[model samples]
Target: MIHSQVNPDAAEALRGLCIGLTRQALLAFTAIVAMPLAAEAADGPGTTSTTGKTIALSNSYNGNSFRQVMVKDWQNVTAQEIAAKTIKGATVVSANSSVTEQASQIQNMILQGYNGIAVLAASSSALNGVVKSACAQGITVVSFAGIVTASCAWQVNYDWSSYGKQEIEYIAKRLNGHGNILEIRGIAGDSTDKDISDGVHAAMTAYPGLKIVGTVYGQWTSTVAQKEVSGILPSLPQVDAVVTQGGDGYGAAIAFQNSNRKVPIIIMGNRQDELAWWKQEHDKNGYETFAISATPSISQISFWVTQQILAGKTVPKKVIVPLLRVDQTNLDAYLRTIPPGGVANPPYPKDLVVKIIDANTNHSAMPPVPPPAP
Candidate 1:
């Protein structure tokens, strides 16, 4: 969290991005308009009043990465608003990718008296129970990232189905519709893998010319993907273009390197942190990969989601942020566009999100009776 307290100094910096820095200020300031006494309390310890505030963030992450950075940014932004005297404090409680552990964490947060909770489900099915229990407590719950269901109170996510369609479309065009393609899936049970693959199959179903040579699951880790690719290459005939979920972009390049093949491989993925390596590797080896941000900078979404909830505004039950394609051509273009507060928001109200989701409801996608391929 860069600034737990709002810095008027931040105004100048935020103005440059034109992200409605003024509007955020205006609305926050307006909250204190009719009631001067509440406004007086804005300067006090600030925790005394929790009228329209206090959100407990329960995130699903195992390590530090873009997602982690984004969460940190969200914390900083929300804290700034609180310090700026916008609303009350929003407390954030984090948990790694364990379903049982995260569920326990949510229970703990509720016991601690948190009013609202933002969660990233470990597994779409596994976390449904957690969401329901949390909602039963009358707490607001928002789920995102690898989470793909519409069951949560609200879900802010990237359109993985669209992301998959676009990447496959790009590969299909590059190969002129006929080539051997390899797919490295993300975390096996995570909603991201299912939605993206669902979109890929939805698109590829029509493109019979493009043959899927070999399929494997990488669990969204570069090391696992590297090993999986090394194993997949020997059994396959040839790889024309490859599409993977995340760091597998680097892994695909490594796979191509291992085989010492001349055939071109295209990697479609997210994660701007890898840009430095991507540039250096491509420049040195002359063979490179490309990617599209599967999910928008997670940091920006957290703040936007938090703000929407706190402002007493109604937001969509589900918000799907789009991704930007990054090849060698425009990699630098998006470099500065990432991190917290990256993309701009669409035309929507502060509370539209609430109307779309009924906090009392519980929804789930029935597990495909047949288990997925491991």
Candidate 2:
């Protein structure tokens, strides 16, 4: 039986540190501000001299939103140790969001003879061949972001199915076991979305009275999610609450308010702005869309998990970090926690990019002023 939770180390650091700080959060800011250095440190200047283990990193996408932060976190941590000249030189290959590109990149990496591969899969199932081949060649394959098939060494990600189950259960509990729910899905067909959607389906089954009145595909965008919800609101029965797969209650609020629906909505998405808006909603009640957010702390967790693998520890096939539920009670701290980039990347010099990043030293004491890119 898949269990409910895990004991997370440094659990306190992740909470509120990146969500709602007025000034850049000392910790969150440290993580982002120092990320460049941390990553550089992980991938030292020289190659094949230290402990002598080659680790190849390939990412699915490094754009914006939740997934973007996740990818960068892995890169940053990897840089720290690599920069310190402890491990062998690390090579990062990417394909943005294209499965074919990722496959090609992996094939190339294998031909070049890397010891292990860390990949954030573009498509969970589509990457099976690459993963299988890597393992066949005596390479350790680890999937950090999405679901890679069993052929990989470890899955350091939140279980999507469980993400849905826990989030929906929380929503049901908030609504006193009965309410009209509007479902918004992330980019359709993505492994995370599918897992979360399935978990929501499973969780809602336990609460039969909780009727999911409307279902729409948000495609994981505020604008798209808003339009989708906007169209559904006019005719559907009044929704008592909402359970969406992506974060962005602002759009959901616009949709809910447009329908003249005034009920609590639960968004499974996490961003600093979510907490900021919730704080405003709690006080003024203007845009009172949602009070709580179920954030998975993917950025922080992914970074630490990769460190374990690089150090040659036995990583669980799947490490499902506990969900952080934030409401009015913790709104202030949460909002203050999200720094400029918070979990996402910030502008930095190309010279500093790497795989492992140490937060304490090897960083500027304060954020560096952007020296206008040449």
Candidate 3:
């Protein structure tokens, strides 16, 4: 009877072991079946989600609205991409208007193993060494707005020379090829500033009628521009027009208004507040001018180009983003969509960026002629 009981107990224990083994096998089968589906879910359509690229944005200055808007837009776009896992992450480093600090910051980014670096350089040529080092590590570097002179880094910018010439030409025509214009220049020694100034001077020489009566550095900030222009107003001659390198146009206009002088035909940069004021002035006195400036959204172009490069798409060493022009016809439209005191231009369309990548990927050098503005 005792032997019979032992046999029954042993048989029951054997049955329990078999049941546990079966449960473990079922779990293993489920995990194996789910692996591919899980991977597909992690990837977004048309993206190498597995690549997990990381990018850094390095800027030398953050005091102006343009840079502020640029950083914000970049954050918004990259945040979405990060959620989709198209890229692993993004970082922004600001040098507080110092080129040396910016260079060091990028060196750290490279050492941290970032896949790409996007920069609005503080100095056009100062950061070349670090940029080259980053490129040597197989990291992509893309610059925009205020570009770098590093040949290894890709550059994307609006045609500042064209911007200057066109803006001055418009004012020149309004002045009938002759006027004493006040030039509110951007930061002294900035590449963008130099290019725009060159364009303005070129136009002035070609027309032989427009004279730059006074010049002051606006430093690319509205408040600074207003104060500087105001300080210089008392000793200046009759200023019939104001040619500016984007940032100071609105401030320059305000200075004339504050002094009870007739507000001149001031060419405007694409600042939202500036555009709003332009529309109001248009309503009040039929004030008319065109908008041309490096849109802060040009940073988006740099961001996209960096992305394409990280994805193994070959891109041109230099790519040009066109100056965004907002005229009287479209002024109200921009005002309707843009925030009060925000930036004016929209983010670049994706389809256009794709075309740019496809067109320039094979270029061995900059085209002999400047590419037409898109």
lDDT of each: 0.62, 0.60, 0.78
Please give the lDDT score at residue 96 for candidate 3: 90
Query: What tens digits encode model 2's per-residue C-alpha lDDT throughout 98-206?
Result: 9999999999989998877777788878989878988898777777656587645666554467667766777777778888888888787666678778888998888
lDDT of 3 by residue, 1-374 (tens): 22232324667756655655565677678779877666444322224433488998998898866678888888877887789777898988888988889999999999999999999898888899889999899888998877888888888876678878988879878889887888888888776788888988887788888888899999877888899999999988898888887767788888889999988988888787788888999999899988877777767777778887776554667786667777787778777877777777677644566555544543323222122233
Worst 10 residues of 2 by lDDT: 352-361
lDDT of 1 at 93: 56
Candidate topping TM-score: 3
Ranking by lDDT: 3, 1, 2
What is the per-residue lDDT of model 1 for residues 88-134, given as tens digits with 9 covering 90 to 100?
66666566678888888878877876677777767767777767877
Specify the highest-lDDT model's number: 3
Which is the winner by lDDT between candidate 1 and candidate 3? 3
Candidate 1 residue spans exceeding 4 A from truth: 1-52, 64-67, 111-113, 123-138, 146-152, 272-274, 277-289, 335-374
TM-score between model 2 and native: 0.69
Off by over 4 Å in 2: 1-50, 84-86, 150-152, 286-307, 340-374
